[model samples]
Target chain A: MSEVVSALAGARASGMVELADAGATGMITLRGDHALLGAAVQAVLGLAMPEVRRVVAGEGAQVLWMSPDELLVITGYDVAPGLAADLQSALGDAFATVAVVSDARALIRLSGAQARDVLAKLCPVDFADFPVGALRRTRAAQVAAAVWRTSDSDWSLICFRSVAGYVWEALVTVAQPGGEVALYR
Target chain B: MLLLTCPCCGVTAEETEFANGGEAHLKRFGPGSDDADYEAYMFARKNPRGVHFERWRHIYGCGKWFLMARCTMTLEVFGTYRAQTSEPPAEIVAKIKARRPEWEGF
Candidate 1:
């Protein structure tokens, strides 16, 4: 099997903001009724179904509520296919649908004091109100993306793998020393 | 830029996060209906200048369809409601009436 490489490998970072690829993270997409889906998630992932636009974290896993009826499961990349299958069988005929989308997206982690400033350059969401665990499905520098605050100064951005290169370049250009994008701060 | 809230996800996102879905509460005139009635159903739309009810999708947010009561003239949003409803909610109609006294219910 050919090894998967991160889209940001060999990319230069501006230092003001630490950019790292959350390498080979597993991702699964699920959609169904809230109650049934929540129950299945709890049974399979041992985590609660997060509130709308929120995240529930467990040991080595995170469940992000993408919508009222949709959720994104994050875990180790190698474990994604098996986890998705396990969830499918556990929730057989109970939920609407489940799919493993691990290879379809690139997960990027941005941290440092200037992280918020860099994100602000891409989307119109008010980061001040985006407290920890808050997730927002919006555009990032013109690409469809979902952003969530992991901690006080850390954020995770997920976007299509195809545009990962563009997104990385945009972030790097904005994070450069005295980078013009920081004006948003 | 219209800012509307998705009732499903409770996210008040910008227009960029939504996709406009034209008029709401459209009644379908299927087979056996008169030609005129079918034409009206397919073509005729009440493009009222004020207090318009329309369908909107929170495509980038919740991926749920919703209804928005807006003013075409002033671009003022009256409110948003779930798309599963066949008609506008009574409370939203009351709000519009309170704001625009000359307006009629949908």
Candidate 2:
């Protein structure tokens, strides 16, 4: 098991912004017939993949609609191991591929009073329409990710594991005190 | 830019994600067809006012071939569905069955 580290520990921007550690979190990929995979995903995660321009939230999980036949599932830091196995079993030969990539992704939670302000400076999506229950599995800053607003003023952003450091540094830079700024990794 | 609705992706992405398939709903020409029919078949299409169905490729995202319904006059895109997605081919069914050796009796 890899040692868990805060996504933004040493990279703090002098009391301006803080980074939430999300390395321990798990990320999974679910692919199949959209309908069948959606059913299996809902059955296993208690959350249905949201429609295009929409999102469905669960207790500790989130389903972002990536494509018509692809979805990115974000589970709790410590979710059930059986979840992936069960999905594989249920999907069986129905899906073209079902990969449990909890370890393949590095999860991060970006939250602060100015989180939205920070995001607005970076992303092109109309954050005005993004609500608490809204999830957008689109690209931000030219990087594909699952962007969601956990609350009216709070948001969560995730990306592939390898680029987590770069994203964290970028977020920290923009989150500095006062106006928008940039940070280094 | 042409707006394409990806049924598989369920999003109306910009034409950037889609590739144009020559013509849609074309019929095969039979032997001894007339010259006029050949001309019409060779280079012609119906430029409709509303509800034009065409074939588009979702190249960037899913890489799945699908059908899209749009309005030519207004350029309003409606819905999309995968090619052969509605029903599986017999060969695909047989291949799937053969690949699943675990499903002996179930």
Worst 10 residues of 1 chain A by lDDT: A6-15
DockQ class, candidate 1? medium
**Judged by lDDT, which candidate is best?**
1
For each candidate in turn, the interface RMSD (Å) is 1.2, 3.9
DockQ of each: 0.73, 0.17
Candidate 2 chain A, which ten residues in sequence have the lowest lDDT sum?
A6-15
Q: What is the lDDT for A49 in model 1? A: 84
Going through the candidates in order, the fraction of native interface contacts each one reproduces equals 0.72, 0.28
**What's the lDDT for all of these models?**
0.86, 0.63
Write the residue-wise lDDT of candidate 2 on A110-150 in tens digits: 66656666776656444655567666554545455567777
Task: Name the lDDT value of residue A5 in candidate 2.
Answer: 52
For each of the candidates, the C-alpha root-mean-square deviation to the true structure, in angstroms, is: 1.9, 12.6
